[model samples]
Target: MSKIDEYIAKRSKQSADFAREYKEESQKLQVAVEVRNLREELGMSQRKFAELVGKPQSTIARIESGKMNVSINVLNEIAVATNQKLTVRFEPVTA
Candidate 1:
């Protein structure tokens, strides 16, 4: 692994709290990337995407920046607005 990845893995093994927070932050980052990608694919600016999704531009900005804990209801609204399907599933964790 790379140096940063190695460090994170070592620290995660050493501290349960760090591991939990890391997982949470990783999930948030995944969501942020997906949302940003979707907006780009739709050729919409943040303001335009927010208008389409019935949210404020600031909300979109926060979500894209991984600073917002987005709700499923809002995600569903975004999906409907973008004419895309949103799917959620549970996966087994691997070490």
Candidate 2:
């Protein structure tokens, strides 16, 4: 693994709270990346995307920056506005 990955893994093993917070932050980052990618794919600026999604520009900014704990309902709204489908599934956790 890369040095950063190794460090994160070691830290995660050493602290349950760290591991849990890491997972949460990682999930938020994943959502942020997805939202940003979709906006870019549609060739829309954040302001335009926000208008399309019927949310404020600041809300889109927060979502794309991983600074917000987005709700599934908001995600669904974004999917609908962007002409995309939203799917959620459960998978087994791995160490």
Candidate 3:
């Protein structure tokens, strides 16, 4: 692995709290990216997407920025607004 990847692996292995927190943040980021990508793919601006979801532009910004602890309800709204399907899954954690 690269140096940064190696460091992250070491840190995650050495600290359960770190690993859990990192994984949580990573999941949030992935969701944020997916949301932003969906909006872009639909050729919708944040403000337009917010209107579709009945949220303010700032809320959409927060979700896209990964600064919000987004609710499943909000995610569902986004999925409906974007005409996309939402899926949730769990997998074994790897170090």
Q: Which prediction has the highest TM-score against the true structure?
A: 1
What TM-score goes with each of the models? 0.95, 0.94, 0.90
lDDT of 1 by residue, 1-95 (tens): 78999999999999999999999999889999999999999999999999999999999999999998888999999999999999999999876
Model 1: residues >4 Å from true position, as ranges?
Answer: none
Off by over 4 Å in 3: none
The residue ranges of model 2 lying beyond 4 angstroms of the native Cα positions read: none
Tens-place lDDT per residue, model 3, 1-95, is: 79988988999989999888988898889988988998899899999989988899999999899888888999999888777888888899765
The residue pairs in collision within model 2 are: none
Model 2 poorest 10 in a row by lDDT: 86-95
Estimate the TM-score for candidate 2.
Answer: 0.94
| Superior candidate under TM-score, 2 versus 3 | 2
Provide C-alpha RMSD values for all models, in order: 0.8, 1.0, 1.2
What lDDT tens digits, residue by residue, belong to model 2 across residues 1-95?
78988988999999999999999999999999999999999999999999999999999999999999999999999999988999988889875
Model 2, total clashes:
0
